[model samples]
Target: MKRFPAAAALLAAVLLLAGCSASGSSNDAGSSVSNPGTGAVTGDGTTKDSGVVGAPQAGDAAGSVTSGSAAGSTSEVATGQRDVIMTGSMSITAKDPIKATQDAVTITEQAGGRIDSRTENPATENQQASATLTLRIPSGALDRTVTDLKKLGTVNFVSLNASDITQQTQDLDARITALKTSVDRLLTLMQQATTTTDLIAIEGTLSQRQADLESLQSQRNFLSDQVDFSTITLSLYSTGTVAPGAPGDFWTAIGAGWAALVGALGAALVGIGYALPWIALVGVLALIVILIVRMSRRKGKAA
Candidate 1:
């Protein structure tokens, strides 16, 4: 009876030990998974925590973060991703530039683009009708957009430019990441800080870092937009101006020459007619003076 009681107590102890081991394993696994792989998110739904903590002193964090940032930036430069900004300008000639402009607007809209600005000039006696548009088109459809714009009129000039900003973007990203880490460390220090002087200094630094982060993020956003959309300045003009080596018939030239000659002769005749009255007045005065001189001579002879 004594042996049986002892065996039963041993079995109970073994079962309790096994259960405790399983529960501990499960708890540890849950904790590891619940923290998230990236970091902690807050009210703004942004990951603010940099997963860096437990440093002995916060003063040296900035320098360490800068060094790490430099290394990360270098790595980013070597990465395979490419970011480019596309810009272009084109000149097209059409019969009616105003109508072409509308077509261009429609095509751009269909291609998921928008006009940033538009200008139109009505045809004057001295100037041709024209329109200028600044368009923002998706980068993926840049070629297609350009082709569609060409269909609106005869393309006179087309220029496309691309700039690579991958390195700059990567550097900015690395700097932002390092700054976030430094800021996190500063916040932790602020909580553990005991002296008011240290707290004030830390807060001032944190504010500066946050400002810089915000500025960098803005730059990143602008760069991202540039990458997503390409800018194109489209110029549409009526085909009023003739290009060099344009086809011309000899009859047209002869007609122009005949018109010019007729105009020149007409101008000469008008000038002669205007001077006729002045010439007649001088002639009449001469005749009267001659008569008076002759009468005086005759009177002298008689005397």
Candidate 2:
């Protein structure tokens, strides 16, 4: 009886072990079939996963980090540093337009600025002399330069305007980065290409991307310049002043009047010269009529 019980217990234990092994094998097969080629199958019939496939690899991870940092830096550049285009206009009555313009040029140069355009009108007897100057001033010193300019003459008008291009600049930066990436990818593809046809195609795409990158770079440079420099359009008018003369005022006026009289006489002579030809023609025609009338009268008397 004892031997029978012991044999039964042994058979029961072997069957239990076989059942556990079969269950484990089935679970492993199920895992292999469920998550094929993904990861190692664990004893629990689950995948021992690492990183996900098609995700950013180590090399690409660095680039992603750099891109994120660049994006953050761009955001800061857009928000913290303002891209503002400033323009100003001022009208002043100066005692001398020429001197005022010269002084304005000097001031602008001293302020790390340049004169973009300048126009001067000469003084006339009926009109005051004037000058219009377009100056580009450094934004940092614009206020001080404006104050210095105001001291040159009586200010008639003053205006200032500011335009913000922060969003525009950010958008351009993002576009430039994308274009640069595309250009790099195209260059890589070109290097890898073996056939001439493939090379030509990749080169075309690369050229286009490089062109777009350069264009965006140019726009960024222009925007940066505009933000750095402020425009000032200054209009200066001369205050017409006649100086008091100690010696030559009377003689100068008398000489001027004499010149005017001579000019009038010369004009009258020119008019008479032009009319003389017509007058001569009329006199000749009248003389011819008189002769013809006298001849007709003599003929009638004879008849």
Best by lDDT: 1
For residues 1-303, could you state the per-residue lDDT of candidate 1 as single tens digits? 755554443333333323433343233223221122121111111211222233434334433444455555556556855789999999999999999999999999999999999999978644778999999999999999999899997999999999998766765665556546646755775675444554565566567657767886899899999999999999998996653333367887688679879999999999999999999999999999999999999999999
lDDT by residue for model 2 over 59-172, one digit each (tens)?
453343245434554667756776789998999999988899999999999999999999998776656788999999999999999999999999998999999887676556
State the lDDT at 70 in candidate 1: 52
- For residue 224, give model 2's deviation from the true position in Å: 1.3
Query: Over 4 Å off in model 2, which ranges?
Result: 1-70, 77-79, 240-303
The estimated TM-scores of all candidates read 0.57, 0.61
Top model number, TM-score: 2
The per-prediction CA RMSD against the true structure, in angstroms, equals 22.1, 22.3
State how far residue 266 of model 1 sits from its true place (Å): 24
